[model samples]
Target: MTSSIHNEVIIFSQAAGDTIHILDLYEKNRKNTKFSIYVIKNKNIYDYFNELDLRLKNLVFIPYPKRFGLYNIQLLRKEKKRINSLFKKHFINSVNHKIYFFAHVYDYLTMSFVLSLSKNNTVIFVDYDKYDTNKTLPKQFYHVKDKMLLTIYKYLVGKQLVLTEKKAIKLLFENTNIKSNKTDEVSSKIKEKYSHNIANQSTGNSVLIFETPTAEASIINYKNTMIEILNILVKAGYKIYIKPHPYKGFSPFLRNYNVSICNANVPGELINTSGFNFIFGINSLSICRLAIDRYGSIYSLIQLFTFRRLNEKDYNIKYLLGQSNEKILFINSLNHLDKILAKR
Candidate 1:
């Protein structure tokens, strides 16, 4: 008897964090598998992954369209034809092979292409953030102007979804139409592969701050609040390092503060968290993830600032962190943060 090979295709268009998820999937299934990756290029995400040591041979980068609406039907058609051609070239006689698609939910071009190829394939939506399904599904199904496109997306997805956390599986079942049989969980095994081997007894006096793109979204005065936090950390005699968000680099004003800056291209999850006594962020999924893995004392500074526009997704960080067995703290005020530092 001989084992059968699995043909898997992954399509994604998101931030550097998503690339980490895709890498995790590839690392797990690379052996005895025919893999093809299609990344809908957005910003420096492609460039960041291209520089990684993981030599993905069949990686395909597709440039995202500037406009993808009714006015650009010709452009859409051209892109669709190109994608179909690429699929045909990559998976010859795809009907005979059982093709599985692990994809993110956004990006019209990639989703449309996946719909075309999904007639004889399995399409599983990969949600990097476990709490995102509720927010994303509503926007796609209700708000999208293209009813045909929405129908195609829904039909292809067909109740299959993948999440990074196991605890979120019940939440998905309770909230969505996705059945328990079709919902799959892929743990963040990439963290284990790259995590530092620090002793359980060691507790350092350094802090690592994971920056978010709140400033880019104009949600809050990110720079001023960051400066305030930096000052508090400095006065408490703690070494500070800030990991700039992959998509949004911090303002130059942060340079005036006494803190070392990390490379913006690297994923926060990939960084070693052993040396730090504290890992801080404003509702960053990276913070919660590292905390769950018992890397450091993770903290969220979400209460210290207020967003101009409210987003439900931003509020889920606390909920997710609460599920962790480890103690993940939330900083409510600068004074409260000072008190915690004093205790430390």
Candidate 2:
């Protein structure tokens, strides 16, 4: 059997951040590759990609069962069959193609389906979040059933799994049987394409805030605290813009404030953040990315609100911010936030 000269690239992405990373990969390999993106059915993600100028062909949307659980053997089997059918419809003779699959490592079902697609294919797992914060096996996966599933997943992927972070590579090496030599970081070509504009500096007195959905779980009145912060900025004459979480559009309460609402469909990292003087978020990875890139004066509101159940992930945001060469400030209280705004 003769193999096609062109490589077939399949991407399974969940959200805007994933889409940005996929875009970087697509732009780099669009020359010799036939690309197909399977977006996990999300209204916001679909809308975001739909608005892009690229007008990508072969974009497929697949439904992810709302109640899908890893341990549910029946559901898992059904889902696997459904996804397999989708792949069969898309690729008539995948064996004759050099297939490349890109997906998040944490998505076990998607990974399983990709593994079943083509035996000779390459699988690259992409994670946009901070590597130190993300765990391949979470605490919930400590159960016997979950452990068995993870073990099976590890074996199926074997040495084919490639991650974007060097820290993640180390973690996988230390935690799993996956060897360091087997895994590699995101290619320098893709990384260069993705971060080409990282050096763009921030200007003007406009402040961009990336809103988080975790506010509902906070001990303090999240709305009130946000309103107070907005009030301070407004009174201090700083133009404020709020980028709502894609999953949870604009908060109605925040509309009352004198702040512009950024298109929630767009990933915060993709936006031209250099237009703003400051960027704020409650431990958002976007803020961390911008901070590392030195796009603006980054600040974290994590210090203000106490969560009912704070975990390592929450603290890791702080660590990531600190890791950046750029100085990122932390707002400890309403008074602290006020003083910081005053100084700016």
Candidate 3:
């Protein structure tokens, strides 16, 4: 269903769970106009939003979580119906402003629902590349099929407002004609030109980002992976520093690691001027490229576990890791990590 008038814009995102903070910034920037966010909740979105104080005085955030996990077609259809119902209940029939729908993930279920309900509305796909680092995928959710869905969504969506050309290349080149050489050339140039404005480095201490299942399904084994990475880097005389993926939920487990955790408020100026190296989970492409241009490597523990999870006969871990050289140096199990890093 379309929004009532031409005066408002609503951001439609999956699980008001993760993106509320990001939307807060958007709401602030567009505060002059009537802007609302419709967050389709799957879990306990209200609790999460309340905990974070995501409720703003002007920006109306709707938490619409379904009671069931839509694992099959029947449930998916039901979920679609539920989402459509919410949009109609909230937006359709109003006449003051044109309604805009910003789809964040653009997955099949959500995409299908939006297409059906868009009837007379403007639909935009968010999740710009400036936000992506193209390093890793979340473990608890997401699948190869989602990648296919994203390809389709990009084709159908009105516009793609990516952060950087490098990110655009990464998204378009997933299975296209954009040559890796050309992409790398553009990526390097972008970093070189923009480094002065965006690049941040740590001068004295370094932080290792241990992103758990929250970062993506590809790199969920946080404990063993973190230990292996720390042990190897420690042996190499690197001091210990750790932080969670900015979007990852708070962890009591990290206390045991004796590390520091940071959030969105941490100034990019601080990271840019401090000369710190971010060893992180590559959920966003910008972070991966940033690390490569500044730190020379992206230490993603998830990549190691993902390789192990792949069918041994189907893919050679060493060869795959070797080919993905953008910011990756090596992917290894704990037993072989030291030996591999020794060679690097």
lDDT of each: 0.58, 0.60, 0.41
Model 3: per-residue Cα lDDT over 1-344, one tens digit each = 43355655555555322243344434445545555545443333333333444434333444434364434556545655665675466655543433333333323334443444455555444442322324434333445655454343344332221222112212222322212221122233322322222223234445445343353343456456556666666575444444333333434555676444543322121234233443444343334434444554454443465433445322333322333334444344565555544543
Which candidate model has the greater TM-score, 1 or 2?
2
| 1-344: candidate 2 lDDT, tens digit per residue | 43454477767766655656677767777877777777765667666666664535567677667876656777766766666666567654554343333334455545555555545454444544444444344444356754465554454334334332211211132333221121222354544443323232334577888886567665467777777788888887788888888776666777777777777776776767656767898766567666766644788877776566556436555565644433556778888877777776
Per-residue lDDT value at 5 in model 2: 42
Q: Ten residues in a row with the worst lDDT in model 2?
A: 164-173
Per-candidate TM equals 0.70, 0.72, 0.50
Q: All predictions: root-mean-square deviation over Cα?
A: 6.9, 6.2, 10.4
Kindly list the per-residue Cα lDDT of model 1 for residues 243-342, writing each as its tens digit. Answer: 8777667666767777778767667777778677788887666776666776447887877876776664365544556433334677879998998888
lDDT of 2 at 240: 81
Judged by lDDT against the true structure, how good is candidate 1?
0.58
